[model samples]
Target chain A: MTLATPPVGEPRHRRGSPRGTGAFDRSRRRLYLPFVVPALVLYLAFVIGPTLAALWISFHRWDGVSDMRWNGLDNYSALFDDPTFRTALANTLIILVVAGAAIFAISFVLTMIVREMRGRSFIRSVLFFPHIVSAIVLSIVWGFIFEHNGTVNTILSTVFGTEPIPWLNADNLFLMILIGTVWISTGLYVTIILAAVDRIPRYFYEEALLAGANAYQRLRFVTLPLSWDVISVAAIFWTISSLKIFEFIYAFGGTTNDMPPPAVWNSALFVYGESFGGRSPSYLFGYASASAILMLVLFTALIVVLRRLLRRDSIEF
Target chain B: MQMRYRRRRVRAAALTLTVTLGLFGAACSADDSGGGSAQQFTYWSMWQEKEPQAKVLAKALADFEKESGIKVKVEWQGRDNVTKLLAALRTDDVPDLIDQQYFTVSNAIVKNDQFKDLSDVHDMEIPGESKTVRQVIPEKYDQFTTTANGAQFLIPYEVIGYSIWYDAKTLPDVADNPPKTWQEFADVLARSKASGRNPIALDGDIAGYAEFWTATALSRTLGPGGFYKLVSDKQASGWNNPGVRNALAAIASLAKQKYFIPGYDSSKFPAIQTKWAQNQADFLYMGSWAPTETGTLAAPGFKYRSFNFPTFGSDESLPASVIGFAVPKSADHAEAAQKFIAHFLHKERLSKISSEANNLTPRSDVEVPEQLEDVNELLQEKKLSKITDGVLGDFSDFDKKVFQPLNLQLMTGKITPDEFIDQITTGQRDFWAGHRS
Candidate 1:
């Protein structure tokens, strides 16, 4: 007992020897480079390469047929002056902030209600079915349901004796699109958050319940705290996916076989409307590329800010 | 454990085998087209295989091949044929013959100087007829056939244009004496509204269709080629032109009167037009294709007829859209393609465009389809102008970005005529400034 001894708390192998600089560690490290280099090369070639190319192309004026001419910042500067582009940018942000807020709120409520419900799996599947269907199909069906003479109006007329409403008109079109985005996207986030919530030990909820915590208090303390990481990831996921939502809104043109009006267009549609779309193709590759670059930069910054704001220390159950 | 390993191996092997076979099949089916042969020319048609136009063309092509001892390989590409053709232009396997709306070909192929000079094509005699290609097609269509470079880039075939359509059975007075002036047309609309019927059926969702009110007005106020000058003015001074204000007033007056059917702005395309075809509305300003498109949906005994846009000036500039063929500058078998154009231009062959396809042919001698007779007569009676003053072909983006939105507001009663002018001027100035470099 009196004899000097190595500290019991200390790891024996790490006492004098380097932790990760050993011959075996060095060899294992060498294996990672070979394993990752191929994937790195592919990612750089396809993703990074195109991103740089788009940036480069954004500075020039090109119709995609003739040689590109340099017009530094003109394409980007022109975007602000463009009313359609402004509307598109505004619509995109509204979808991101407004629709996103709605989707998360509804998803959480659904998850909380479904958590203790009977036949939860079947209910979850029913909620998730719209997410699995094609956006084009969903948009078409949604449009038909809210059309002037469609289901909602028909019901209102017969039941309440209300006059038909113009749901798909210009003033209301963007609002309908926002509502649609929420309806279509909520289920996915619900499934994800529910999965994350399910991972928490059941004992935590039982403990909260035993402590005289109400349902809301239990969700606020036990459920939400545990699901923060997934919720954050889902928020970031929605930010990215929402920007790429084209088919749903594009299909809402509703048999006109034309792009929807500029008033309702989002950034995704802005890119398409400026190039390779409509009966008369614009082919404004440079301008469209510029808009694409702006969208990318703005969203990338948003994701970074979002990540910082949502960061939390992982809690051990 | 050995059995499990064997089963896993079998599964992996099956997947590998299936992937290999899939890759092979994809490679085999990649492309079947070959380089042009000595006496064969390839054609990429804009008609779908099952369409009436394609049927007529198929029969004509077969007969041409039998007669000339030259084969024509055709791909039945649909409406997006020009888009496909443009992509193929970069490759070695370019189609020898291509066809599309004249303005479409003008904007894409002709604008880029990719079309062969077809001024000689006009003089080329039809295969079994004494008349030349130019002789068969009306001289008036010559306005849209040539490019700015003075090259006859397109050979006119099908002629389409905007007209004020109506059911003759419902509106006998309109059918008997079609309105020839803007005042008279407005009177007709007022009268129709008073009789407890909606006057006009507009698919307000279609900007082009909605813009008809303004475009026709401009065509009337600004005489021949005035609309083009108004649109293409680099200084953006065209909006100040009195004619622009005049055109705006016409549409503004219509919107103010609520002459359009209720909920017209929100009603989807084909819905409003189909209702008009079913005689729910008295009039619809649409293209010549209106009748053929709505023939099935039309109420029984619906006599489809149309009148030219009512005049505001002495010179009546009627809108005409030509759908035709063009040979690419780099075509492999240009001679055969040119020869086929001549053979197909024959009266007998061209007549099928009207008889079978329910379309108007540039050859006035061809018997007019029942639905298209009124428009054909109007084209002959009025001074023909390129549809939308050919501005859609040259400044399509400007129209979409700057003009169409403002035009929509003007037609929808969202903005006053003066507000539209002011806003359009600012929009045009901004647009050109960005594009000037």
Candidate 2:
């Protein structure tokens, strides 16, 4: 019933105020009644309700189908012992740093490149092409490119004149996935930084240039600080996206069957495999859900840490 | 004229947006939901709904509608039916009749109570077959669909078997004919490699491949009860069981000798099937149902054929085996569902489906279509095996979780046959304890 509502507009505004429940005020309530209830209900039912349900469901031993049995703390206990889950958590961390650092560094460089270029629009479009491609599809291409006897091998064999390095072997499968994830996601951050940079006054950059500030000085003093708000937001998106990275890892490394060589399964894939009975004698929905909850905690902590560390001095350009 | 042109442009843009949104919405609406008329009963099926058997089903319903004035609507379950069906069941939107894979229905039945039993209505006639329904269905497959309380709700449907496939060009070069003994099989691989070809296009990571290495071969060679002594009874373990160790070692030996295509140690193993079909390999192991046209042997100017897995040694006797289907207790429309299922896999409908959709039939009485008769002839002549009997839960889940890691151990040469048994017994006991009903 609550999901029947939309998420905007207000008689919700008036109802919160106490003294407005009278005859003249009642007309405003009546005017806004139809619009407010639906939106409020929709938010309450879908967004708020499910988050709470998922939180509650994390404690139970249910495989999404069967009866949910109470197993308090057991799920959490199992997580520390799950090597694959530990591997997954480590991989998630590696991905977050690799993808986040790459996105931030690439976008910052590209932003400066575009600001100083005459063909800025064309350059921006070229840089932003990856954002237009779905991460899953890009992973497929990445898999083929990095697969044994695939594109990278062909190139390596021809140029380097060496034996074909196994791109998707146990040693490098996760790294290959990280490259694919970063490449597919970097362009969006560039777009975000560009939008923020466009808001800054052009005079500040001109003044910095006139004062004999070199390109690097102009960047450090002017563009970087002015674009802090957008950069922080984009970086936050990156951290969270990397932590929540499932589709590309799942699609490229394979969601089912095409697993990373043994002992190399990442946390999401590990939790997913154990939960889905891909493992023998598998029964750890509660453990998986707990690991997922642990992941959320890690994500929040990392975001807070990164935000504090990178919370830059905002320039009022 | 200018105003008219502007209006046309606006209309074209609106149409484009609408079409794009429509396509997206349609994609999201890919959940399988069967619809029925006032007099009609709806049926939902897994696998290819576009096949002629499905069309025949719709026609049967149409025939009933014409005579008895009842209509029928059918829907195809998606490849993602596990996710979709759970959502549908939660909504209590089960169709009047559903032709689900016995495994899908079974997985739901034990874990979730969503099926209806139809033992009383099991005698319903199929279009062509004369055998009683009981003879056609296997008990172990029936066991899969049974409840923990030992209730028989689901009926067996079609049984499919996996086999060894090769291009005819590679086969004669490896051996005079396909090898019957496991020793000869190893020799074939060696000869293939000697002839500068890898022997098999094996996808080591594929779950079915694990079973092909472990359960299918082990059970078929050892028999149902022998497999039980090994898996359930825990009597058969280690290098003592030649089939188990030999299969794993055989695969590892192949890997070591580079008898497999290059880079198989990684996940890129199956991606080399084009080369396998290109006659770069002498043998490839897969299901008998997979024909040359669409499978790994699918290549132009390539001739595809198959034989049963080779025997282990001079002492070993390998009999035939299979993977069969059964009805689940949780199926909502068991009586009507069984009738529809019977009609669907009935000899006439089975032939139609095999012809149109390239599926294998469980019933031998059904005439094979001219196109797929070669595949059928191979199954009959060589006595190609199945994995239906013995072991716990087809080792379907067991193979991936236990046997694979153990095989990797074999590949690394870390574990001997005795150690392999210790590994399986030690690890899989916990698994079997938790999983077995």
Give the best candidate by lDDT.
Answer: 1
User: What is the fnat value (0 to 1) for candidate 2?
Assistant: 0.19
**Candidate 1 Cα outliers beyond 4 Å, as residue runs:** A1-49, A254-256, B1-33
Q: How does residue B102 of candidate 2 score in lDDT? A: 46
lDDT of 1 by residue, A66-171 (tens): 6679989988988887888999999899999999999999998999999989999998998898899999999888777877767888999999999999898777
Error at A44, model 2, angstroms: 2.6
DockQ of each: 0.29, 0.17
Q: What tens-digit string does per-residue lDDT give for candidate 2 at B1-437? A: 77556655655665566566557656766644443334555555554566544565565555554654545565666343444555455444556554444444554444556555555544565545676565555353444445657665455444444557776654655334667677777777777678676777755545445445555455545654455456654333433566665655565565566676766545444566556667666666665454623454466655566666666533222223332223334444444445556655555555554555555565666665543454566545543333433232345345545566676555434565567677777656655544411
Which candidate number would show the highest DockQ if scored against the true structure? 1
* TM-score, every prediction: 0.90, 0.78
